[model samples]
Target: MQKPGADFEDELENSEGAEELYERMSFTVDKGQEPLRIDKFLINRIEGGTRNKLQQAIEKGHVLVNGKAIKSNHKIKPGDEVLVYSETSPESTEIVPEKMELNFVYEDDDIIVINKPAGMVVHPGSGNYNGTVVNGIAWHLQQQSPELTEVALPRFGLVHRIDKNTSGLLVLAKNEKASIGLAAQFAAHTAHRRYIALVWGDFEDSEGTISGHVGRHQRFRKIMDVYPEGDHGKDAVTHYTVLEKFGYVSLVECRLETGRTHQIRVHMKHIGHPLFNDDTYGGDRIVKGTVFTKYKQFVDNCFAICPRHALHAKTLGFIHPTTKKEMFFNSELPEDIQQVIEKWRRYVSAKGIMTEG
Candidate 1:
């Protein structure tokens, strides 16, 4: 039997919302097949299938035979058709709704554009069950429109996600049709996304492109690694333009040609310019500053000013899924990032004056 966690790795290449939960599997019995209980039959045929899971699906009216919902004891006869609908996994049902304020940038009957704050998780996963954007949206929907809560799983139409520390604009679909429509655009690489990042070093050129394969690190599964040789991982590309130079750090605008997990973070690190104060990509330390105690203290103060990475999803543009119209949204940098930038500006100006004096 296939392993329980087996997945289509190649699908991650073009798919942005890898964690969106919905699955379907179907099978047709052979002409010579003998009668057997549907649950038993499925457990034998489906990879990583368990009788308990099938029973739960059957109880939830997700198991159908010959176009009708069936119980676990329903027998599968020769030439029978069986179908099973599921989420990402049985454990995904644990998502709970919680009341939390959401920053809705744009909202209509079909979609919602949220200006997510830093330190807020986009979805629920290991070590995070409540206090996610999804949970907050779900609760908001339930309170505003209780009828929409009838669905088995309450995702609140989240289509894509930004990192926990990366504050920016994110779009969510209000229904399945809208989700499908928006997902297609993201998969096609037609959606325009721009990010502003403060990296550790100055760029030689005003603009450039970084191309490499991004995938899970073999040694560290929690972080991503760049495969420049194209031997492994999915193809990823980032185009960047230097917006300002601060001797030890540079602020750059990054436009993503392909969205991958940690695409901006991993790509910047690949080029020796990891995002400032990004703990995961080794940006929490002073990568470009001097070795003096004063310099170290200044860098540490900067880190304290911006507790998270100095990256923001500054702009998002995409076609309206239902309206068939162009939609665009922009957001300002969070206060922490802004403060750090100002600090760097003042430090640079002071150093220039000292050198001249």
Candidate 2:
């Protein structure tokens, strides 16, 4: 379930049936790619696509170029958008609408904002194909209009994404036009997003910015890493303000400048302040605290209170695609985060050395 990348291009394809190939894969021809047969182009991109299977798919109108069915010999040109609307891989393709509970923050014809809980993945992928944000959205759309129940909502429903363990607010586009508008806003850095995180250290400065190039790690291909002085990854910026400082940890507010994958988590780790309980970047342990058994037990209890990364998407802002008006939404810290903060607050202020940002 690794994302398609330069090192490992492991994406979909299978020869189960040409007709079963659903609208699963989307690819934009690179500006530098020379004219090549559509079949050849796809076989190279799809992990297990065979020449015979692709030819069969083309005959059955499973392949589209610029939104039109094409023959296998059709030449692909630069900037041409190719889409495979087949169940090349059922898990990633089939949009099964499993009914599940979700916190609906705001809803309208063209958009919906959801206060997603932690442990719920934003979309279907890898080990989790059901009980995701997408599944819930599908069910909601179906329930809103019974006629549409038989059909799956287009992939445009998700305008942006957050990590599975990161809980917070998310705005989803209900249509293609809205998707385009919102996507442009995110790409241009006009959309605003803020997160609250508890990191494993106290900061000397009240506020600061962390900027670096974020891309796939060379060793751990699944997770992201920082390219501080290299040109291998996308440029990312995260501004953070210390909200409150405990003896061994601090509550921080992060406003993202560029929404790279895991931007806040990566930037915080780059500065040696990984989010507490974030196991991926090594924040699960007591980084700066007493070695005594009592303090260890206290930290362990806090971990149980949250049981996940101590991060939350507190605010999100964007322009309404249809209304042409600025839209903003905020969410209170979830109960897990609130309880942990209060626990630290009581522990820190026992003496008079605690400081607030």
Candidate 1 local lDDT, 296-350, one digit each (tens): 9999999988899898999999999888899999999989989998898899898
Shift in Å, residue 68, candidate 1: 28
For candidate 1, report its TM-score.
Answer: 0.75
In angstroms, give how far residue 212 of model 1 lies from its true place: 0.1
Worst-scoring 10-residue span by lDDT in model 1: 10-19
Model 2 quality (TM-score): 0.76
Angstrom error of the Cα, residue 79, model 1: value is: 34
For model 2, how does the per-residue alpha-carbon lDDT over 1-357 read when each residue is reduced to its tens digit? 223341321211111101111224789999999999999999989888899988977875657789677888899999998977443233345667879999999999989999989988776654555788888888888888878844344355555677778889988888766765565566556789999999989898999999899876878765678996567777888999999998798999999877766778878998999999988788898888877898899899999999888999899999998898999999999999999999988887886756677
| Candidate 1: segments with Cα more than 4 A from true spot | 1-91, 148-156, 353-357
What candidate 2 gets wrong by more than 4 Å, as runs, is 1-92, 149-154
